[model samples]
Structure formats: structure tokens, C-alpha cells
Target: MKRRAFFLKAGLAGLVVGNQGLTSCAPGPKLYGDKNFYINKGYQAIPKLKLSKDRIIKETVGLRPFRESGPRVEKEMLNNKTIVHNYGHGGSGWSLSWGTGNQARNLVKTTDAKKVALLGCGTVGIATATLLQESGYDVTIYAKDVPPNVTSNLATGTWSPSSRVCAEEKATPEIKANWEDACRFSFRRMQMSLGLNDIIDWGDEYTVRKQKPSGSNISGGHEMFHIDGLNPEWKTLAQKDHPFKADYVRRRSNMIFNIPSYLNFHLNNFLIRGGKLVIKDIKSLEDIDALSEKVVVNCMGLGAKAIFNDEELYPISGQLSCLVPQTEINYKLATDGAYFITRKDGIYLGGSGIERSWDTTPNRQLTEKWVDVLSDLMKDMKG
Candidate 1:
């Protein structure tokens, strides 16, 4: 819509005043399927303005950066080279990049080396190099794209790291522990970056539920989330002030990151910290190991499958359509298969449960379909 309709569909705007005072036209998110889904809590909630206008201007989509199981946070090699692999963070990389990097850096704790070579310039690489520099090690980042162009910038990142973790991730107790630690550590770290707009801040994200949602709607499958109890760094909505009891809502001051802003922050500060970026393509593990100096962290995201030959590290394939920005609202909403939110640039919307859909190409028709569903949802929102 004008950005208002977009933000409303994205759960950024709450119930509005209509011909009747607080009647059937109160703002709420659309419900597609019947399930126990929570409000997305990704948008900045907006109250109905008595003396102003509303807007909904943009639409966008992004992949969840899927990888099987927990991110690869170990050290391995090909041709006897020390390769500290650190990629495979399906959708939670932006939220947990530095925490995982901290874990990856710990692997090289006893090494007396003062310089480290890192592969990839995405969030993982940048975070790893940043941590290394903090630890007195000179780090050089190697990759094809840096910052704004990297997959990291494509993310509508927040504090919940394991939001899209694969079903197979909860297998081992130790691995589960690692997952929990990463989630907790990451959430805490994000809170620390609040002073700067680039890295992190507390924004409102709302999720609206329908009485009975259907296919292509919110799945409500995440009834029970297991982790180190790392709830989004936001506040939870209480029942007394809730909009719809049939569709429960929660609010919080969770971490909401503006990708471009933070990516620029990293790019501007990397070299000042003595961090170097080497732009090149590494076809094989040998190329990566040969390029770096002492230690190597592989935050390849989806690229891990090819570079490391990881058959399990497959793409979860997600798409988001972007539109203009609406600062009046700032929250994120997640339903069955669709999610909506307003960031710095455009209002973000998503709906994709197609397992193994390799069609990375952004189809304009598919985007319109997703947007249509969102609009239909608004038409069907409850009081």
C-alpha cells in the first residue's frame, strides 16, 4: 500500500479508529492457518493516529540462510592445512555471528601466533576478524563480496538466532548446549550494541494471529522453543493490554538490526582496526587454506556446501520482497509461512515453506502473490 498499508500488513501498525470508535476496523495482522503461532514482534508498532495519515509503501524478501543442524563451528582441513570452519548458520547468522565467532576464536586459544587469515567477508568473517583483532591478532578478511554486497546484508536480522534451526539440530546434548550458549551470548551481545543504530537496538515486532489459519498461513509449529532461554531481547505483551485474546500477542524490546547500516559500520571500521579485505574466489578448500595465514574460519553460509563439500549444508531457500521504508512503524511479524516487518529501507514480507526450492531468482510474480496474501490477511484481521 502506501507505506501504512504495508506496515499494517507487516504488523507494524495496530488497530486503527474507523467510522465507529475502536470498532471492527482496529488494526491487526492477518491469520492464514489454524495453529498456535505467536505475533512476529519484528515491526515497530504504531498506534492509530487521530490527527495524522497512514502509509504502506514497500515490500521485500530474503532467504533464511538455511544449513542443516547447528552452524559448523569446528576446525578441519584438506591437504593438511588448518581450516577453522565456521559457517552454516541457516537464518540466524546475523543474530549469532559474533557469538559463533567467539567460539571459533576460542579454538585457536593456545596458538602463539599474532596474525590470522580469515575467509569470507560476510557477517561471520567480519565478526571473526573483529574478535581476532580484539584478541591482539592481526586479521585479514578474504572473500568476493564485502559488507553491503554480502549475503549478511540481505538479512532482516534480529536477536533470535535459532528461529529457523533445522529439526535435526537438537540431537546431541553437547551440540544442544552449544546452540543454547550461542543464542544466549548473541542476545546479550546485541543488547550491548544499542548505542549505535548500525549494530543493534530495541524495536517492536508484532505478530497477529487468526482464529483458524490455513495453508500458506502461519504454521504455529514452534509451540516449544528450546535454547538457553534466550528470549528475544524484547518485552512480552501482557494479556490486559492485548488486542486479541483468540490470537495471543506479545511485545518486547528485542534486537532489530538494519543490515546496510551495520554492514557499512563494519566496512568503515575494519581497516582502521588493521583488518584487511582480500577480494577473490576460492573454488576449493586448498585455495582457502593457502590464502590465509595461521587460522581460518569458514563462514561461507550457503557457500559452505560447495567449498567444503558439505552435503548436509543445503539451502533452505527463502525469498523476501522489499518496498520503500516506513519509519512510523518499526516491528516484525511472523505467521505460519509468512512474516512482515519494517526496517530502515523497506517493509519486509516473507512466505515460503517450499523445502529445497533452488529457485534463487527473484520472481516478481511470486512476490506479488506473497504481498496479495498479506493484504488479504489485513482484510480478514480481527478486532
Candidate 2:
């Protein structure tokens, strides 16, 4: 069949064909499934994604604060003040926030200081602050940006505790152990937030590929943690059982966050519990020394690079283009170079991973490329 005709048959490009093309064809009876009708008997038709320039809601870019040695969750003494370091989570900030917060809270609990100062109001900072408040410590958060403007808001909003968290060579025994604890704790904490104003929920994700993935292509880092059952079990689907135009499809369920709502919920919870937030930027070590609290938890993310002289900290730029929401499309799809996830806000399309790039400007070309990739994948879709 011709490419255009195939698209038209699949109900994907009738608008491009125009009214003239429709008028040219004589009216006939609509055909139903024939020989292969039984093949799709119980299968639900995958809803076609309305991919177009007009459907796009917005394009956003975020810089993941990557560290080669993984997240630094330890305490340091500086100028008579105890600075508990809890930053550089990279792409795993949201996924591992609760676990890391617990680690930071433990460090603070050991200190005699009853009042704690938190730097940066991003996910990590908020989580740490709330945890400390719950533990009976008076907490004050000082940050340059919050909520909609924070880098955490630009995340893809999926559970990926190890994504760019650390390099392969840096995943030592101690780091792996700490990572496992965080993953397990975060997974349990995330479960407690499910159904709370839809801030977090579980959804199936389909990883489609043109060919079967080889052993080397499969990631084994998650296994190294030894946190069994933390994530949903993966199941390989038969070609006829799935809807993607791919030779292999593996499906698994994972937790996803409605970032805006989640942040708001936590921020509100903190405020209700008497936690204070002050809008301020800590530019240098002098700024840190000016804080009244003797115990300070630094969750500055990438901003820690200059303030703390963390040469290991760098940014991994990622872009996401969101489209109008479709209520029926609840699952997530991940192809070779792009991924699409359905959320209450919009249908997020993402896949750009530019390392050590500090630029947060959305790339138009990259957005177009992702659209093209999704369009091509759905061309052969049945529905």
C-alpha cells in the first residue's frame, strides 16, 4: 500500500488529504475485520496520539545535576557550622528525594542544633525540610526559586533512582548500598502518596524496539542494588499482543509524579507544620555563614558547584515537549530515542540528553524530531 493511503486507512492523515480527496472516492460500506479478526479479539485498541504543532502545550528544558561519585549525603563542618550536604541527585532527584531526605535528617538529628537551615527549595530541599519538621526540628528554607520555576518541576516525573545518578566505575560497594536503601525507602514513601490529589500513581510503561535487545543493551544496574520487587516485574509481549509498530515490546509498571501537584502538596504540608521559607540566593560561603542556624542542610543541586567548589557537579540538559492531554491514553511509551507519558497536565514527549550542558532553552528542532519519531511509530498502528 502507498504510504499516504496507509496513513489515511489508519485514520491518521485524513486532514492532510483534504475534502477534495474525500469527494473523489465513492461512498461505500465501511469494512470490518476479516481474516485476522480473531487475532485482536480481546485486545484493546491503542488510542492514536493527536500529534501536531497545534496540540503542543509547552516546551521546557531542565538541567539534571549529575555527579560522577553519586549524591553526597554526608555532614561537613565549616566555620563552626555543621553543613549537611544533600545535593547532586541528577535525574533521580524526585525518585530518591524521600530516601535522601531521611539520610539528611539523620545527620541533622545527631546535631544539638534545634533549628535547621535548608538551602534550595527544590525537591530535595523540600523533602529534607518536611522530614526534619516532622522529626521535631524547626526548619527554614532559603532558596532562589520554588515550585513552577524550580528544576525539579521540569523533570519527566518518573521513578528513576539510578538514571545518571553515578557512573559505572563509581558504583562502589558503599555507594550501591546507600543507593539501595534510598531506592527501597523512596519506593515505600512514594506508595504513601498514591491517590493523594493524584500527585503520584502507578502506570504501565511499554518499551518498544525495532529489534530484540541484546544482552549487552540491557541495563543491569538496577539488579546490582538487590532491592527485589521495588519495581514492577517486566513482561515481554508477543508481537500480536501489543499495539506498537515494533518487533519487541516489554511492559512494566512504575510510579509517576504529577510534579506541580506533588510539589504543592509537600510545600503546603511544610507550611501547615510551621516550616518557614525565605526567598534568597546563597552565592558564596560567606552567605552560608550568615545564616542564624548552626546546622545547615545544603540541597542547592547544580548551584552547589560554585558555592561549594564541587568540581564534580555538572548539568545534563534534558528537554520535554508536552501536548494536550487525552484522558484515555494513560500508559507510557518509550522508543529508541524518545518517550511519551500521559499525565494530568499533558502528554509529555521527551528524549534529549545532552551531557554537561547548562543551557535551559528549549530546542525547536529537537521537539520536531520527537514528533516525527512518534508520528512514524504510530503510522502502522491499527487504531
Q: Number of the top candidate by TM-score? A: 2
Task: Return the TM-score for candidate 2, rounded to 2 decimals.
Answer: 0.87
Task: Report the C-alpha lDDT of model 1 over 97-165, residue by residue, as the tens digit.
Answer: 878888988886655566777878887777778888888887877787776677777666666566565
Cα error, residue 359 of model 1, in Å, equals: 2.0
Q: Go through the candidates in order and give the clash count of each.
A: 56, 0
lDDT of each: 0.64, 0.85
Deviation from native of the Cα of residue 237 in model 2, angstroms: 0.4
